[model samples]
Target: MWHSLVRADNLFGPRHALTAVHQQLDVLQGLLEDSRGEYRHEVLRLSAQYAESAAWLHEDSMDMASAETWTSRAMEWAMEAGDEAMLPWTLFRRSQLAAGKRNAGQTIGLAQAVQRHERALTRPMKAAAIQQEAQGLVLDGDESACHRKMDEVHEYAASVDSSGDARSGHGDFCTPSYIEIQRANCWLNLDRPDRAVDTFQTALAELPDVYQRDRGFAQARLAIAYVGIREYEQAAAEAAAVLDMARGSGSGRTLQEAVTAGNALAAESNVPAVRDLLDAVKESAGF
Candidate 1:
């Protein structure tokens, strides 16, 4: 269910997936309240997952308070589950929320705090923490430190194997494609869109089609890189790809990036593809 729930976040986006999770959680929560035998721990485990997913969706939906509430609830259930596996993950999500808010210091602090619990972390979670710290460094405008952190990310990436744990985090997909995409994102944050464009293209091509929604997001990032370099034609084409995928996925993230790219292009000279992409972006805004 965790696997499918994460997939739904990528495929159908937050707003759509949250509805399903909420329905399932309502029943599960009730059953959990009554059960107190062998299955109690199991229910707690499942409850933790549902709460974590809800927190993620709420964060994406721009409901920070709800996100915080669910995240805290997830931590409680995780603590009851006794494995303590979800502790690092819950902290990781909080770091992500800080990053989303663009609070670089808070992002770095939370990510560093995750690293402090290094003994409890899985390999995948370690990689995620390092990458997140790098993102914070980028936001701090520390190019050298950010690049160094990415090197750390690559080292951990090599240790990453074909394990299910690698795929648990919301944005941290734990595939090689995901690493490549993060590399591109680093370049993007560092304002080296020229470098980012190629890396993003590589990541997009390498991404497993099973992660359908992720492909859309990579395309949107690629489009932005193109726009950054004034390669309006390529930007237009990439934006078109994002729009096509977003139509199927209803990805708010994809739509948000598409809107940004479209507005960027609007300021420059116009082409038919550019105009078409912009119009399509406007259409998807309703999603």
Candidate 2:
């Protein structure tokens, strides 16, 4: 069931994924109410997992209120089940939500809370928490501190086996490529899109094909990098590709980034390609 949810999230849109998770949650609730003892505890843990999945779907869809509600429920279930590992992971997820809101202080504080449970956290979890904190540092414009934290994140990530603990279900996405892509995003935030272009290209090349959303996101950012350097043609090309992905996947996050690239290219609307790309974006976005 968990594997299905993961695959659905990768291949389908947030609306589809959320529907599946909610159906699973309904079944889990019935099982939880009927079972007792260790079996009930296991059911509770599974419920927490589904709830967290829903939280992530909501966040990616840019539905902050639903995301917050689901995340809080996941945390509550994790605590009730006495799942120590999940408790910290929930905190890490909250940090991501804070980062989405651009709340540097809250993001950093929640990530630090995740780190405080180091004994319960897997190495990948540690790396994820640290990487998230570095994003907060980027928001604060602390380039040096962000780099230092990224170094620490890589150290933790390096210790994970090559398989990246996919079955272990802890920080499976904290692979080297994921970390590097995040660093490229930070570079963009720091107004170093010149450096970001090369970094994003390298990371995207190494990124697995299974990560459709990730690919679209990186491509969207790469479009922004081209726009930053006044490469309107390349930016338009990338934006067109990202728009296709966004339409196919219905990924609000990817769509948002693609829209950003479109807006950035608007200044060069005199260029035929740029004008066409803007028209496409406007048509897709319905604004």
User: Highest lDDT: which candidate?
Assistant: 2
- In the range 1-287, model 1's lDDT, one tens digit per residue, is 66766766766667568888899889889989898966998898888888988997787665789999999999898888874667768888888888888889988998998888777776667788888888888899998998888777765553323333225443346566787888899899888999999999877876766666667778888889999998998898988877766656555667678778888999664588888887787787666
TM-score on alpha carbons, each prediction: 0.88, 0.93
Leading candidate by TM-score? 2
Model 2: per-residue lDDT, tens digit, 84-162? 9889999999999989889999999999999999789888889999999999999999999998998788877733243
Instruction: Report the lDDT of model 2 for residue 134.
Output: 97
What residue pairs clash in candidate 1, if any at all? none
Q: What is the C-alpha lDDT of each candidate?
A: 0.78, 0.85
Q: lDDT of candidate 2 vs native?
A: 0.85
Worst lDDT run of 10 residues, candidate 1, spans 157-166
Name the runs in model 1 displaced over 4 angstroms. Answer: 37-39, 60-65, 158-172
